[model samples]
Target: MRGTGKADVFVMLAHPVGHAKSPGIFNEIFEQKGLDSLMVPLSCRPEDFDTFWAGITAAENIRGVIISVPYKVPVYHKCAAAHDRAARVQSANSVRRQADGTWYADNFDGVGFIDGLKAGGHRIAGRRILQVGAGGAGASLTYC
Candidate 1:
């Protein structure tokens, strides 16, 4: 059950956020799970990123944030702790605020892709996978 005043806030931060579907997807998941959480989109430009991030992190109710596009690398550096995979790739798409007020970063883009493939009955174990592109997604997929 959620209190009327404030709920745990999860934000999706992006520069050109118009195409992002994360808010709706996570909001639906929260509602279905009966969690007192809300996912919101925060559109921020490169120059305004630092200030925007600082303001959001200052909020006690902020639970986590999903970084998109150019912000992923920046957010990865901002995190107090990072998963080894994220460190290896130098990118992070997910960040969670710990109880001690520190941020933990991880990359789940590759996991999600692999999960989708498994769900579709694709076998990956002992299989040689070749991935193209050396961009963020490619780096994450290759690392995972």
Candidate 2:
């Protein structure tokens, strides 16, 4: 159950059974931080969220969850609360469990995208961006 002791975070990717790069990306970060956390890819469908989340959340030491495509909107509806960014975007890519056992949803894709662009020396303060996508990932970039 969750490898061993506790997981500082749990990642859920909604891709309907496909290869994902998130695991490698997040696992590397977790390793660097020396945190007792792991991001796993759950091969889930759009309808298995309730049961899946119930089982995972019931596990000990799972501090948070990462919601991906197809599951984002559903999880958004189930979240206890959402950050201002998620609230405005009506979507979420991350979920954190609060001290009071409440779930908080937040979206980081927009900021990450902006940061990625800025990292490449792109001035985005007042720049026009033509993003491509209408799904969850697209919604994540809505703000920018």
Candidate 3:
């Protein structure tokens, strides 16, 4: 169903993509919504990142990319534009191709966590939350 026509392709990029859950999750969501899209899991050695990214960017049908692990920051730096969340931390877990084929970056690491909390009926406005960890994901959480 994916390679049939002009479906918007999405790539989940990680060093070792074998463990990626996003492609399956997103694919399931697309199926449920009847979206003409596909999320494909892909990996390349660190050394191949630059070349891989170049090729990916050249793909006119690649509508978006979900970045993970070591490539988030790299991909963020390559974006033509970014949300404040991503700009502040210099990291991006997601990017979508712009109309001109450039990428626009954003990070939902923190937003998703808070949204999950809110969905679970946790009061964020009048309560406190404890966070631990460091690096890209940590910085994003702190910024949020």
Index of the highest-TM-score prediction: 3
The alpha-carbon deviation from the true structure for residue 101 of candidate 2, after best TM-score superposition, in angstroms, is: 2.1
TM-score of each prediction = 0.87, 0.81, 0.89
Tens-place lDDT per residue, model 2, 22-110, is 77788888888776778877766556768877776676566777777677777777678998878877788888888877679898888
* Candidate 1: tens digits of C-alpha lDDT, residues 62-136: 999988887888898888999887888888899999989989999978888998999999999999977877665
- Candidate 1 residues lying further than 4 Å off, grouped into runs, are 1-3, 125-130
Best to worst by TM-score, what's the order?
3, 1, 2
Pairs in steric clash, model 3: none
lDDT on C-alpha atoms for all candidate structures: 0.85, 0.74, 0.89
Model 2 poorest 10 in a row by lDDT? 1-10
Better of 1 and 2 by TM-score: 1
Model 2's alpha-carbon lDDT is 0.74
Model 3 scores a C-alpha lDDT of 0.89
Model 3, runs deviating above 4 Å: 123-130
